[model samples]
Target: MEFVERRSGISLWRQIADQIRIAISNGEFDESGALPGELALARRFEVNRHTVRSAIASLAREGVLRVEQGRGTFIARHTKLQYPIGRRTRFSAGLAGQIKSRGGFLKSHVTEAATGHVSRALELEPGAPVLRLERVSSADGVPVSRGISWFDAERFPDFANRYESRKSITAVLNSYDIEDYVRISTRISAHHADPATLDDLKLSPGAITLRTEAVNAEVAGRRLEYSHTFFAADRIELDIDHQAGTALP
Candidate 1:
């Protein structure tokens, strides 16, 4: 029996939706690529048909399912893209072979004083100037991640304009005479999507997100950028390479 706690305060439908998502990840629906009818789901979960319907509705809103009126509910054809995290991680390069189109564009940019978190990440004083960029990355035109990055404004006064003219961060850095940068560290976690990230990634309220806080520095060890990126949980899988310079397939 699927354990959905009756009096546990969590809504029944939400619990069921999570159960269905787990089952999907486990390939339970591979045979048909569609969910069983609501009646069947209700019986399997020991819930009323209405409760099952609500679960399916919620999953549909999260892009996990496609509810076809006359035919049947089907899983969305979203195979998770594998993203490699290594010393030389580049967003476009990581997903290049797996996707037909990949791009990241600036949604907004600002020059502001460093907050405590940003200051520490960029190795700057509390009130030091920084340039921040808000960006969205897409795979095959479907937005999959949102990122915020900070750079030392004094060092790269023209960073935003250079990045805007050239969509590639690597390219912009190259123009700044930075021949190479390496990922110093990357920290990853999963959480319920915050309101801003949810909107940026076009995800529903309860959707989960995989977040990474990464720092990059030049070969000689001068910090170049500190960034936080949120990837829609359903659409991407973060692959950590034990080998520093390993390439993804």
Candidate 2:
């Protein structure tokens, strides 16, 4: 049993809930398919029954746990969409067949000066001009992810307008004679949703988000796009696919 961290600045119930979620993900309770009783959890975490119950209630609200009148709390059976990340990753194509529909329009775009990691990822000099795009993606009519991408403004002067017209990033790039590109690198992590993301994802305060920082470039190895994305953790799962034809032709 992992003792709940004391004076960790986080609420006792929230810490307990996070631990429980991790335990469920690890299949620690799969044999029983239900969590230990409130009393047992209370003792294990050195907290009161009320604290343990609060944790359970939060998980239940998140649809991670199901509670019955007499039966114990059990893990909810959820079918999260599997999103593939590989050398070539695309939104709609990655979720094909798994979803009845997949598409989202650009929310906004602007030309801004590149700074910090954005400059490094795209191999642009610091303070160079870049076209930034803010977009959201959906699966089966439900919001799944939000993304922000940056491209060299000088190189793609009309990216925003072209994307708006084509409604496809690939098409917009293709018009520039960029026939093929591949993902150069990607970094993944998890964090709690920020206020804006919570509103966009329609999730409560404690909802989790899966974050990815990725860069894509042409076959000639010229970096073209640098992006930051966040997926609703409970609704989508990311998988690494190294096979050929990872992206639609």
Candidate 3:
């Protein structure tokens, strides 16, 4: 049996849809890969048949399930893209062979004094100047991840402007004569999508997100960037490279 929260700030049908999506991803269905009938699903979810139908319809629209008029609903061939996270975690390089087209665009940018978290992550003094950049990354024309990054404003005062033209963080850093940096650490968590994340990632209500908090540093271990990235759970999965070499550039 499956459980759906009644007062979790999410609609019942949407919650059911989310659960069904997750089940499909996990291959919970039988060998035929077809979902159970509406009545069975309703019973499992403790909802009405109409609500179950609504959930199925939503999944069908999202290309997660195929519904034939006479045939039952079956899982679609929408495999999640695997994204590698390693010491040298370049966005474009991470998804190179997995996706034909990849892009990152700045949504917003601001320069402000670093807060405690940002200051500590970047090893800057309290209230040190920093550039905050909001960006969205797309794979095959579909938005897959949203990221917020902070860089030392004193070192990269023109970072936002450079990124607007470069469109690649690596390229922008190169222009500043900082040729190489590596991921120092990454912390990951899962959560329900917020309104802003839903809008940015084009995800439905109650969608799950994989959030990664990362810090990048130069060859000498000087912090260069701090970022928080949210990835659509259905669209991509993180592949952690535990054997990634940390050789300095």
- Candidate 2 lDDT at 29 equals 86
Q: Give the TM-score of candidate 3.
A: 0.91
lDDT of 3 by residue, 1-249 (tens): 369999888789988988887787777888888889998888888999999888888777656788988888898777788988889988888888888999767999999999999999999998999999999999999999999999999999899999999999899989988899999889889998888898898876667899999999987899999999999987899998878953222
lDDT string, candidate 1, 1-249, tens digits = 276889978788878887888888888876778888989988887889999898888779878999999999999876799999999999888998999998778999999999998898888999899999999999998889999999999999999899999987899999998989998888898887899998888887667799999888998888899999999989999999878963222
Candidate 2 lDDT over 157-229, as tens digits, reads: 9999999899888899999999999987888889988887876766656678999999899989899999989
Deviation in Å, model 1, residue 60 alpha carbon: 2.3
| For model 3, the run of ten residues with the poorest summed lDDT | 240-249
* Top candidate (TM-score): 3
| TM-score leaderboard ranking | 3, 1, 2
TM of each candidate vs. truth? 0.87, 0.85, 0.91
- Better-scoring candidate (lDDT), 2 or 3: 3
Q: What ranges in model 3 sit over 4 Å off? A: 7-10, 245-249
